[model samples]
Target chain A: MSTASSTVLRGRVWKFGDWVSGDDGIVRFSELRNFADDHDPAELARHCFAGLVPNFAERVTPGDIVVAGRGFGIPSHPPAPMALRAAGIAAAVVESTDTAFIRRSLNAGLPVVTCPGITDAANEGDVLEVDLAAGRVTVNGTVFAVKPFAPAMLEVVDSGGLVPYLARYLAGNARA
Target chain B: MRQTVAQKIIARAAGTETVEVGDYVTVTPDYTVMQDIYFYKNIKILEKLGVHEIAYPDKVIAVLDHTPQAAHGSIYVDRNRESREFARRTGFDNFFDVGRAGLRHLIMVEQGFARPGLLVFSDEPNISSIGAVGALNVPISTEVIVSMVRDSNWVRVPASVRFELVGSLPPGVWVRDLVQAICHDYGGGDGLIQRCVEFGGPALSTLSLDSRQGLLAGMYHAGADTALADVDDVALAYVQERADGRPYEVFTADADAEYDEVRTWDLSALEPFVTAPPKHADVVPVSDVSGRRITQATIGSCASNRLDDLRAAAEVLRDHPVAPGVTMYITPGSPAVYSQAAREGLIELFTERGATVLSPGCTTCWGYLGALGDGDVTISTNQEHYPGRAGSRKADIYLSSPYVVAASAVAGEITDPRPLLAREGKPHVHS
Candidate 1:
């Protein structure tokens, strides 16, 4: 676990209704299997929100954010978060999400801030700034507290993902 | 420090003597059972993680239920192909593909992949569907499969909620009815979120293994993270009967275990409860919606559909035929249950009465197969009734016990099942 300076993420927000499932909402489950063997992350990225949002792949821009209701990115699918990162999204701030959704986002090296009432403060297309380490979010010119990443989880994300985290762990073990 | 059964199980898996509520422990699960729906991404993720050898090949249990018997050009086939190859390369010992089993949750317990007090991860929130045998199962994310292969994952010991069920289940009253009552008492789907619900009380011992499974499987309806049933002689004998001579251990909660909340109810107070659609706790008596037009009737799934369930359905359909226009699908929960149902002539009775026997799988209930047409009203013996859960958002699904499903199928609408089950000389005790 490392305690580094708090990182601030700035982006335009996109909102989804409650429980927009990880499989159907973030990306179609079929798209996951169709391009699975291709080993192409961009292929997954292009089809992100394929069924839920029309022209998602064409319209989505870098550093755009998603503000979802409870149970965001649920159903235990890994490719959902990876597709988010590959699409160049900055972060996702949710009212609540499943542990797996958060962990998958961490594995994808994506930041997810769980905050109550933050969704109400900002409308869709609102510009927001999320400070990771500080547990603060600025939307509608208002600041509110949000859940911060655990020191260890933050370190894992800093290393660029679980694969690099494991590599770092193995290297450290070898040195020790 | 009064520890609960949920805590004890986590303690053992975390390699600690004891643990308190909210303590996050790094745990290596005894068995990780993955269905085909979520395993495709896991395999690809493992490849990217540079996993040469699976960390616990012997501990992995992969079942092909969600996509069992893949059709031509189906996405399910793609998932099945990649997942099978990944299991082969990773050297996982137990991969139950199509024709072997339907639901991994039930198949895992039947094949001894899960037993008392062994940490189990089934990936979906419905993992507790196997808690009947005293196994603590977590419905986790796909990343968990990756962690189980590469290293381990952290588990925070959840505070246990005690459910004390007492009294006897009268005719037509099943665990499905009792579960709805529990959900209503605990706050519907919003209640057990993130909490560990522990079932107890005298009547628990009398509930059949299938009934216990139904009770456990109902945890997802209330949004429970996981669940545990106190191991009794009934659960023990059932485990031995299905364990294939494998060693199984039990963990008991301390006599004075602390509970965040305790709710008690008598089974005699329950009747044939039913859920209309969408939310599980959105329930009322079957008589409330009697004669509501139904186009489809299904009597099978991972949760409620079992041998006893099939028998209950057959009992109603034995003497009478299905409604003139309404069609019914009878799916056994597993190959073993399917065989038993066939041996008991339940399959014969169903087809003779205009019911179609489906292959054993989550098929229609999950909307992967047996999808209903638009605006079709269905009465099913399955758990989910959520919008678009049964493939079509326009179709309405009613969740009920097999007894109710059977009777309702005959009438082509929601009907009280009391008359169908009150017949004399009933030798069978439907779970």
Candidate 2:
């Protein structure tokens, strides 16, 4: 795996959010994440989501730092990024995580981080290490403060984000 | 580097000049999307153009869904007369008559009007709603229809608001809510004036077809046109179906499609969002401003008010009553939706909640129905929240999802729905 420089988020790293999985056990592509004048949301939807989500449940492994931007959890349909987190496809979801994704990740017990300016530093495959407590990112071990992520957010990340933490006690349980 | 499908399509359509950012190219529209008013006018325009029989009338569609009824009998008659006359004169055999369809964008997909790789355009803001098809793709117009029809290609320009979304979002929160939040984050009504807005990121796939449509609709600012990805097969069906010969080629950039700016959004961490009035694109978290009182609130328009939208609102209004001073109106996108809602008990629920259900048509949000009196504060699901959208230029309008609107109707203010729904520790996934 190639490491990037922390001075400026200069590496290729794939991002995974809580809003990515689908009902048919497939990976769904996000339109907002991609911007193109000729892009067809429907075609992308069918290509990525019609039958499956990224299949990250099986495709992703540990040590992967998923880079995220803001307002991530905006999908109305369920079974997205939640299932991926539950399956342990992502090691740490970092960057501007939205409220819904945060809530769902915490419930699923996924590890997530929120570090601003991280996207600019990372590319599609660059491995990144982000230290939330120090508000620093170490790409290939070089460090920079860049921007600070909320400390309160770390607690949620530590709790596995949302699903795994909550699912253990509530599987098949009736509404209280 | 591999060329994207859009790039390939553009290359195919563009014979000489390669399509690029900021390049003024006429994108031939494979299919034309029309709403109620323009369909009538276009028939007259066609007569003036002196084309007795349409060259590709099969590729064109006429959807009547604007004003179904007027307060005054004469006005109603006049509007209907124009609508019927246009349908008859244009030889438009493919007409989605009122009461049989929902919004034009939604119906276009349900009826398979949109197909993948098909370049499509319309003369309105709501054409962006077709982005939900997941396979059928095309260019949508933000300007007048006549210009696009004369020359199929819309000018390819860079976006002013480049939102890079990276996280997961809540289920109830949708594209409409996020767009409203963006509009709110900007200046509400004037932020996107003449500016292109591009929404991108890994989180976009998480949105449903309907939600994507809502986002496309929300991108309409006075300054720029609207567009979205129709990169794959499901999208192809929608585009190909509308193509004049074969699917209009997709126009995309080579890995490096140029963009003026980029903003990222993490869906996971986003709260159920909202955008308060006088601005259609302004956006805010539902948690930040729910329960704020209002005078009038409405749901339904060319851009919003689908069956799912209505169902969500119904879910919230199930047992609640409208706030004492608030008067809520729920207008189905078309007569079919109206009938379906009635059959499904959504209409009854809306009525029980003290909501007034209007005849299926474009009302409050389209600057029709004299929807508001002076000083009326309205919350709607329409795409843009400009002044005079609701009859009164001074009226304040808040844009939100059906859930937020319904919740606010009961609380009598801009309040979030999380607390009322009492959703327990569901996983909050952010990118």
Candidate 3:
């Protein structure tokens, strides 16, 4: 297992369909109800995709990617992406997703790329390579272009999420 | 370059002349709004970042809207208390305590914090409701903690999709129906994904600020990043009355502004619509599934629950009792809305008809109050009907207008409100 700060990632794909809700699909709203102030990633990870794919938490290995169809992660609940990261998912390649989902995913230390046809191009258990910097995905000898994250946002993902990025930012400002 | 309304607003906030789509710029929001549900979580994140002070205390606003009365239990009670202490510690005068609380989206506009051409960052997408007054609210989810600490955050300019609303809505065809129809048409695929939606054209003159807010708030169902309405006298008048000497700017789209897509919708052509359970965009006309029995009904949420919505519900519940075995909950959006509904006799009519009048907050819409039992079918004016949103996953929640919710409660089934409206004479459209 490797951190997401690496520019390129190789993972087995886990496929999902369109409109998989962040609340109900990725992580159930019920799982989020009882957290004591701070949401423990390990606890949330145990329930990640438990609603959609039973035993997903146990089966998913670190650096495995999530590929989905359009409108993935609707109603972008903040903890859904965090739960995915905690459950060892490295990156998400989707046909489309809302802006909030993109921001939340990056802030949770998970990188998401929007590729127009990634869902149909890849299958479950297929080994895929994602080039985060180049905004390209390769599967089965086929390549697809994806919308790349902006440099500033990429820096946040590279620093292992927004909290760490802001820590460094505030420290840099103080030093200056 | 001809810029869209959103571009102009962002440009002003970013201190730039203009911004093109896909351009990332750091901008200071006019207001950074927080709700109780995520307030403590944000503070925890801020502590992790080692930021002790809020960068812009004057621009920060916190509201105890989601669990104002701590409807759930002790956790919410504790969170609410801590939120108050944090606000006081930070010297934030904009905190709306329990009694003054409402849905943050509505309170921001009602209190004049969300004004034309100002940018707001919030935790939920429905905060786009501020667009009704020509303000843009970007939903940053948990990242609002970043904005609170820095007073600014980076935003990627999104392409705009323009919906030119034409013609007036027919009687009994509420703004919710029109919004659902638009969602049904444009929600599929990537038509509106991550895009800014702007509403304009001939019908803008007739739609009230409440209607416009209702319409904009539902754009999230269509996958819009955020939404805005063209500024007009109707919007300006409402803002001027509430702004209370606060300065604001009004931005309009250039005549030749570029849009990713231009769509025209005739409001009169819309019928009473319903977004069925499990999907916000799975919209169908009310007649398609009219006779399904309903055990619970509610008329509240950030999407609806304004004065006009309450009045609409009252018109349907007038002289009628909720059917046996049916429980209906009515939540006004804010204290002001509650007081006005009381003055207008809407609350009295609702209570006399056997419906529960909850405090002015998120209420059942948030799955906090009036949680449904297993196998309970519900008709509600709230947005989002994902499984288990209102308690039981076995329960089926249907989303519609206040009129439909009231009528369905009265009949104990999914019933159209047009017949009831006809029986009661012409329906009143409150602004």
Candidate 4:
């Protein structure tokens, strides 16, 4: 478990509409069946958003960020966010999302920021900068404030998700 | 400070006197449940974290409810076998394997694990059904591994929204309709996100335990963090009969407790409603799509597969055969429900009327049984009708009450259940 923190991410934006289903729009449920036992990041990345956006896997470059309207990741399964991270999505900024989805994304090592007016602030193909520590996003010279992760949650993401965080905790405790 | 039922429950679990909303606190849940579908994944995550010992074996339960019969394939069979072995190795005597298991939500309630004021950690949010008895369900999704390994989880105490339901539901209109009505009204915006919904008001006392469970189970579709209902005699009696000597505390909200919002709903004014295909927020009255043809019908899910729901379906299908070319499937929520339905001849009535009786598990609801073919249209009591949820992406699923699903099965179309119930003299009163 690598404890690498990319607090600041710069990427092109992939804007989506409201209520983009995490299962169908982010990653098709059928595609998840292929990697049920072994969730290979590269293999899962190949099918990200294959249903909604044709050749999305081929067109998308690493370090791209996903921006969407309200209720993003509704009816999301756990694997949906993992698929996004595996597909090299640096962060997700949305108008709003369920708390469960937010937690799931952070656990998958993807920072999900909830900004009230993100959909209207950013557009497709525009470059955006996300700062996790500062809790802000910059697009087109405009900055949008986002709800920052709690200090504990930031530590979890900094450690590359909860598993590694726990691993480090156990190791530190053992030394003591 | 006065605290709502949810706040009080969380405070109890945290071993604190009071916990305000938004306060992040570490809590030791009363119980933690694992189901078949995610059991392997959870174990894999635990292994990755290098944890071996069971933190609290007695407080842990493992059940093979999703694919109990291995309907999907040998993968489920392999997982179930591995789950059995894990249970034995961990000394988790609370494990419920196939034939002994049903939906984990209903199992938690029927076996008296979900007593009033207790906190439970589960994988799926719909396990909020246990809240019918005032128990709080905290769904951590795949993060349930955190609780399993550490025997504790961190939670941000959520604000509460109270639904004051008044008056009794009219004939042919069920709790499922009432839930859909709530979703239709408050599901669109972020009003319910990260908030706990509390069901109260005069109508709550009139509702049976099954009806209350159905209502709370569907609260997740409305984007609630979790839901709980006011516990009354109806809930307490049901728990008393099945509690198996478990000690429980009954907590009620203080009159001066704070809430994010409180809305009143008149049950008698509600009409039969259906969530149109694809979007749960696109709920409409049954009359909007009454005559649409349906190729399949199902009356089973964690939300609406209790005895009253079965009886409602049986009442509609009695003395009538399922329409030709229409396949109907009925699944009981738990083994206890199945046995009671069988004793009451509800199962026989359904089978005789050409409706298939599946095992007591999440069968059709989870897309394990009665999977739809391409272009098939189904009226179901399942929780979700999202695209590709049931089977082929080309197929469509409309969500409705058991009464509507059963009547639609009889007519091979989405038919309002009131007309059919009127023709049968009167609607049967649900217990």
Model 4, residue A47: distance off in Å is 2.3
- Model 1 — TM-score against the truth? 0.84
Highest-scoring model, TM-score: 3
In order, candidate lDDTs are: 0.75, 0.52, 0.85, 0.84
Put down candidate 1 lDDT per residue, B90-109, tens digits, no spaces: 67657787778678878887
lDDT of candidate 4 over A1-176, digit per residue (tens): 11144777789999998888777778766446422345788867876887778877778888899999878887788678888888878888888877778777777888888888777879999998888878888999899876556666767777777667777766773210
Q: Write the per-residue lDDT of candidate 3 for residues B70-133, one digit (tens) a residue.
A: 7454577877787788878978778899788888888999898989999998877888999999
Best-matching candidate per lDDT: 3
Q: What is the Å distance of residue B61 in model 3 from its true position?
A: 1.3
Between candidates 1 and 2, the lDDT winner: 1
iRMS, candidate 1, in Å: value is: 4.2
Share of native interface contacts recovered by each model: 0.18, 0.00, 0.67, 0.33
- For candidate 4, lDDT tens digit of each residue in B21-53? 877788889998878767776776677677765
User: Per-residue lDDT for B129-176 in model 2, tens only?
Assistant: 664443223333212233323443333432234566676666556556
As a whole number from 0 to 100, the lDDT of residue A118 in candidate 2 is: 58
What's each prediction's TM-score? 0.84, 0.60, 0.96, 0.95
After superposition, which runs of candidate 1 have C-alpha atoms over 4 Å from their true positions? A1-101, A104-148, A159-176, B48-53, B75-91, B185-189, B241-248, B423-428
Output the better candidate (2/3) by TM-score: 3
Computed on C-alpha atoms, the DockQ of candidate 1 is 0.24
Question: What ranking of all candidate models by lDDT puts the best one first?
Answer: 3, 4, 1, 2
Per-residue lDDT of candidate 3, residues A1-176 (tens digit): 54444768889999999888888889877547642244777888887998789889899999999999988888757778988999999999988898889888888888888888787779999988888878789998999887566677777877888777778777773210
Per-prediction TM-score of chain B?
0.95, 0.79, 0.97, 0.97
Please tell me the interface RMSD, in Å, for model 2: 21.3
